[model samples]
Target: MTGTLVLAGTPIGDPSDAPPRLAAELTAADIVAAEDTRRLRRLTQALGVAPGGRVVSYFEGNEAARTPELAEALAGGARVVLVTDAGMPSVSDPGYRLVAAAVQHGVRVTAVPGPSAVLTALAVSGLPVDRFCFEGFLPRKPGERRGRLREAAEERRTLVYFEAPHRLEATLTAMAEVFGAEREAAVCRELTKTYEQVRRGPLAELAEWAAEGVRGEITVVVRGAEPPAAGEADAAELARRVAEREAAGQARKEAIAEVARGAGVPKREAFDAVVAAKNAGPRG
Candidate 1:
């Protein structure tokens, strides 16, 4: 009979946050796969529970080569447990490859709930949580990062992102440039840790604060763009937005329709606006 594969969540910061089920699984699993063997040892030491079976390293460097081996163990009736250095496995961490291999081999898969920095940061960000997206991390390269931010400029859902401490200032600066200086945002630092802090304000303000140097694990939450005030969107503004969309590779008709919907104006009005703008000579 095929065995089960358990993906367990570890504490993001505080070791005390480790769930009871985590310790139970650690002691019961027949094969434990950890992102970092030494860190896993530290976690088990803190929990005061030693694994009853073999432990193996599974991380970015060896995941590709090790997943199949772990999957075979699962297929052979071994209760294999997967855990990362922090939070849930497979969340911008190692575990996806092994999970995929297990699924392909008909092995049952499950999970143990635990703390998450993403949700923890979002809850305290002072931004809308009704609808939000977790953008794990931005591109490290400046050009790629700016392009990604530009693509999400008009996103209506609150945006969440994981970033390194050293890059926080640059990332915030890019966000300020692309998402608007006055866009509301929150910077969550070292969540669930002793020095945990949440800084809430406009993008430009956060950028300035980060510029002066910030530390610890960082998660940034930015408020979605608000629709223009009613009657405040004139034909020229509508035409300009549509043109911007068109320049970004959207069809002219679709861009006009999008602008119309965004501004709550009729499509005919938007079309007329574009035509008028075109005939009124080049905009200054």
Candidate 2:
């Protein structure tokens, strides 16, 4: 029988945040795969646990070359523990390759849950937290990133993102353009660590703050758009929205009401949308 694979989460900042299970796993495992061996040493020292196992580097550069070797160890019934620099493994970090290979080989996989910057930032973001999606990292190239941002402009659930300090300003600027300047957002830096800061404001303001320079890991949370104001939409714009929905297969009346809800306009005024559509015909 193949041995089980354990994916342990490391502390994002405060060493005290390290869970007891992490230390137990480290000492119990037959081998430990870490993103940074030096950091792993520091972590074990912090946890005050004697690692009774072999330590190996399993970062991005060597992930491909090391996957097969690690799988072989597991096949030999060796308990393997995987750790990243911070947070849970495979969450925008190393460990995914091993997990995938383990699954392919029918190896048991488990995790020691620990602190997460994504959850921490979202909790304190003051935005809607009922539903959310994590966008691990955006494209470094401006055009590709902007295109992706545009697609999520109207997403109702709050959005979470990770970005390098160098690109935070540019990414925030693109978010302002796509989601609108007035959209609410929070920039969380060095979460749960010294110099931790959470800047809450409109996306445009956040963009300006990022321009001044930022350091440490960052998690950005942005509120969904409030939708366009239907009272401010005018007749033509209302017709356009209704027509667009109808083009997508909604009945004319239903489409108008839905558009009204989205635009924050009264349903009565939205009724005019159907009439406008008739007058304009199917041209536009």
Candidate 3:
């Protein structure tokens, strides 16, 4: 029989936020795979739970090489508990590779629910959380980052992202450029910590504020694109709308449907508009 693989969530800021089950699991595990062994020690010290099992480092530097070893332990009926420095494992963290290995080995996997910077920031962001998407960390390269942002420019669902403090301004400026300067957003910094701050305003304003230098862990929540106003949309306008959605990675069919809905026009009318635009030669 295969042993279980537990993905535990650690406190993002306050150690008291650690789940009740976390301490028990840490104490009971056959082995603990931690993103940072030093931090794990601190966490265990805080919780007053000494692991009955061996603890090993499982971070980006060694995750690839360590996954197979951990999988073997699970296959050998070892109850392995995985924890990151903060938040749940495999969420823009370092547990994905191990989890994938465990699943492939037919090991049972479960999670210990706890605090999350993503959900926490979203909750305090004052943005619509009814429908939201987490984009994790964006590419560091300016060109690549902008390309990624452009792909989500037409998304109607609220977007969330994790960014480094030093790059917050650049990211926000890029957002202002791609999503429009007036786009509403919230910059959540040092969340759940004593210095926790949520600055809400237009993307341009946030960018300007960040220009003065910001610090600590950051999560950004941006409002989705507002639907075009209902009106009699001309062929050119409909075509332009469809093009924008397509440029942002939406399929033509879905884009046409959305454009029609926003314009309060028939889907067929939107289709016709797109066709008309195609038939007309490119604008000189």
Candidate 4:
């Protein structure tokens, strides 16, 4: 009998958010794989449950090397419980390789669901939640980050992202520049913690607010663009929007394409308008 590979979710902030099954699994597993051994020790201590098996660190640095060993343990009928410092494993964390290895080895895989920052932030964002996408984190590089925002400029579904506190203001400023200053958004910080705060406003407004400084795990939710209404499209407006995007550091080609799509107009018309505007020279 092949042992099961359990991917358990730890608390994001509050300890009570941990599901009852998590404690049971912690006590019963043959081996516990933790992202942070010290944090895992604290969690176990909080839950008052001691594992009957060995506990080993399985963080990003060692994930690749430790996966095979964990898979072997599962193959040998040792129940392995995998847990990150918070949230589910493999979600911007370590665990994908181990899970994939277990699946490939014919080992059964399962999850013990718990509190999730993504879902929690979305639920409280006050934005359309029916359709959405999770963009875990933006690139650290400014050019790459701006390019990514420009790519999602016309997305109609709500967008979610995790950001470091220090980068929040810059990110929001970039977002305002790309997505429009008036775009609605929310900045959720320290979710479920004592100092939890959700600042909701236009991208420009939030950008200015964040400039003052913020500290915590941050999740940003931005309302998606509303599709252009029938017969309301203006080629000039599309071209101007494209120009704004270009000025904000987005590639000219991408700006044109995104603007055209967003305005529900032909790309050729948008391109022509931009060309005409450029040829007309600077305004007096």
Note the Cα lDDT for every prediction shown.
0.89, 0.87, 0.91, 0.92
Off by over 4 Å in 2: 227-284
Model 2 Cα RMSD, Å? Answer: 6.2
Q: Encode model 4's per-residue lDDT on 42-97: one tens digit a residue.
A: 99888888976899999999999989999999999999999999999999889999
Residues 156-234 of candidate 2 have per-residue lDDT tens digits of 7789999999999999998886666898999999999989999999999999988889999999999975556545678
What is the C-alpha lDDT profile of model 1 across 206-263, one tens digit per residue?
9999988999988899998787876768988888877876665567887787678767
Clashing pairs in 2: 230-263
Model 4 misplaced regions, further than 4 Å:
263-266, 279-284
* Residue 254 displacement (Å), model 2: 24
Model 3 accuracy (lDDT, Cα)? 0.91
Least well predicted 10-residue stretch by lDDT in candidate 3: 225-234
Instruction: Indicate the TM-score of model 4.
Output: 0.93
Q: After superposing candidate 3 on the true structure, give the runs of residues whose Cα lies further than 4 Å from its correct spot.
A: 236-284
User: How many backbone collisions does model 4 have?
Assistant: 0
- What is the per-residue lDDT of model 3 for residues 1-284, given as tens digits with 9 covering 90 to 100? 99999999999999999989999999999999999999999999999999889999999999999999999999999999999999999999999999899999999999999999999999999999999999999999997898788777768889999999999999999898778789999999988889999999999999999999999999999999776655537888899888876765567997788778767789999999999999896777
TM-score, every prediction:
0.87, 0.82, 0.86, 0.93
RMSD of each: 3.3, 6.2, 4.0, 1.9
Query: Which candidate, 2 or 4, would have the higher TM-score against the true structure?
Result: 4
Q: Is candidate 2 or candidate 3 better by TM-score?
A: 3
